[model samples]
Target: MKHEFDSAFHPADIAFKTLKLAPHAWVPNNSRLPVLIYRRAVDPSTKDLGKTFEALLAGNEWLPQWRDSIFDYHHFHSTAHEALAVISGKAEVIVGGPGGEVVSVAAGDVVLLPAGTGHCLQSTEGRFQVVGAYPEGQQWDIRRDALLKEEIAAMEALPFPRSDPVAGRKGPLLQEWT
Candidate 1:
């Protein structure tokens, strides 16, 4: 899956949607940042969705950080924005907080989470896998549905990632986030 980011390539070619959040419990949903969902960002039938997705994100400066063996409970990061590219299998995910929205995602899907957005794996098909990454120089901190005053403040002050994990600086992420 060699992609040439030349004249023929445009970030808008990949379709995506933005999901806004309101304060929910200790999740402290990011009032300014929205979760991004890139539907079928990659072809599910591709031979190496993980590798391709990783390369795509890295190319846009979203540093590949971990393999998506995500936990089952709801959680969020207050210090960094994150991205998850589904490589194989399908899963039901809950986003926002306890009262968040639930979405079904499968291979070739990419989900971009801003700092302070809550997410959790509700269920999954066998052999589920994903590639996770973060913006350059960003570190992540995990928090459950309980938060401190300082944590809430920090989450509110966190800056948006400089680039979209799948589409670079000019991608919809900047347009929607900024």
Candidate 2:
């Protein structure tokens, strides 16, 4: 669907929730990666939700991303924050760690994972697809439930992105994370 605010989309129009985390066995010691969820951010009637979501992220400076399905196992990125926008189908995702919370997400939903926040695809419907990306110039390091001391330190030292993947520099992402 088209919106009058499309040219001047305000962050206030979008409702976001944050998930705080503590250092787990596999995850490292650092500020709880802010988990921001934007529900129904896209219009269901819109075709090609994947490309649209990618464009939104890219516009906000979350670049060098990929389009694919989420892995059905627990994993975390110690080096960079990640954003996942559900383009099609539905799935249950575990966030924060193996014992983290399970969230049911579908098309038009967006999830922002801070560095070191563990996530996995618990279950999925027929065709689950997500568009994933990172902040400009950031590469991803995959880590399961294990980490070395230096790895933990590096994760703790990782910098927050200047802008939100979905929102811009003045979005809720910066407000909650920084």
Best by lDDT: 1
Q: What is candidate 1's lDDT per residue for 1-178, written digit by digit as tens?
A: 2122321134335667778888787777787877888877877888988888888889888998888666788899888888989998899888987778997888988888988889989899978898989888889988885778887787777766777777676667877787
Report the Cα RMSD per candidate. 3.9, 3.7
lDDT of 1: 0.80
- Give the runs in model 1 whose Cα sits over 4 Å from its true position: 1-12
lDDT for every model? Answer: 0.80, 0.78
Clashing pairs in 1: none
Per-residue CA lDDT of candidate 2, range 55-163, in tens? 8889888973788888888888888889999999999998877788898898888888888888889999868889998998789978876777787787777777878
